[model samples]
Target: MLNIKNLYASVQGNQILKGVSLAVNAGEVHAIMGPNGSGKSTLSRVVTGHPQYTVDGGVLEYDIGGQMTNIIGKEPDERAREGIFLAFQYPVEIPGVPASEFLRASYNAVGRHHGLEEMDPIDFDVFVREKMKVLEMDDKYLDRALNVDFSGGEKKRNEILQMAVLNPRLALLDETDSGLDIDSMKIVAHGVNTLRSKRNAMIVITHYQRLLNFIKPDFVHILYQGKIIKSGGPDLALKVEDKGYDWLIK
Candidate 1:
């Protein structure tokens, strides 16, 4: 579970997120919707502790063993190790490192953080292959360089693949629906739904309600001008689709 209170974050010298507050409990999916420059992506980066962003005010906390652990100054890697996962809006391409090698290294790192043994190469292949099934991915994908030369859909699906393997308690998907076709969106959404459960939560940052049709978030929030202005159920998304952010902004 994650709780943020009046969080203000800045990139370079310009402040982006101002007075943002949100709480994601276990098993709940919260969809954050807003127009460009509303700080939806900023919220994701701040939550994941991106280096460019500085938290100037308020508290960011994560629950560990029933205690509210302050995560404001935590390093990005520390947040990842503490079970925070962020699916970037645009996944970067690593040209040389094979996906399998990169994924295995990341998986092992998280495993070590949780006091679990690292799997050997052969064992990791078997373990990752099982997870790949959830995403309907091919074994050939593992041999390719991470996101290198992958289509937009492939990169998005690859992010979900990482999420499935990492099994984080809190997953922040930053516009995962961008650049994806309807079929690809459905596939990616299916993968996300498969991973949902009582032990984990997701914060979906998106621009359109189409993704909502598939994932069906438990709560919908309209984030405008760096603050969450309205919160409602799934019907809120349908209203956004019908009336647009202009209505909400007004």
Candidate 2:
């Protein structure tokens, strides 16, 4: 489970997240929905230790393997190594590094954190290929530079590929459905739905209920002005889609 308390975070002197709090239990999928500039993305970055956003107040804690750790104080890499995974809204590109090499390095480093030995090169190749296949990615993608020239949907699929490989305790997805067409979205959603289990939890951050239509969440949360304004089951998403965000502002 994860616990966040009264989190006040800022970026470049502007307070983005003011008094945000939420909890996600294991095996539960919680969807965070909000209009742009509502600090939905900021909440994910602050929890995962993005340095650009300073945590001015409150605690971001994670209970991993039954140990409570305050992740706000940890570095981004350190937090990643500690079973917290963020499937970025926009995955960055590194032109020189091949996708396979980047994943191997990341997977090995994270594996070490769990006291697992690194995978041999051959083992890694097979492992990555299988996961990529689940994402419907071709083998040729492994040879390409990480996210280099990848389409928006491709980038999103690649993000889930990391989540599949890392198998972290907590997965934070920020607007993962953006730019993905329905077919591509289904592939990504199926990958996520298949991965849900008691040992892991997911927070799907999105603007619409379309993605939720594919992977049903245990709870739905509406975020407005950096705080959780309302929560309900799937019906909340239906109401939002029927009424749109216009009603919420009023």
What C-alpha lDDT values do all the predictions have? Answer: 0.92, 0.89
Per-residue lDDT of model 2, residues 25-131, tens digit only: 88899999988888999999998988799999987889966887787778888878877899999899899999999999999999888899999989999998888
Best by lDDT: 1
Error of 1 at 231 (Å): 0.8
lDDT of 1 by residue, 1-250 (tens): 8999998989998888889999889999999999999999889999998888999999899987778899887899999988999999999999999999999999999999889999999999999898888777877999999999998988999999999999999999999999999988999999999989999999999999999999989999999988899999999999999998877776
- Which residue pairs show collisions in model 1? none
* Lowest lDDT 10-residue stretch of candidate 2: 64-73
**Backbone clash count, each prediction separately:** 0, 0
Residue 194 lDDT, candidate 2, scale 0-100 = 76
Residue 231, model 2, lDDT: 87
Q: Clash pairs of candidate 2? A: none
lDDT of 2: 0.89
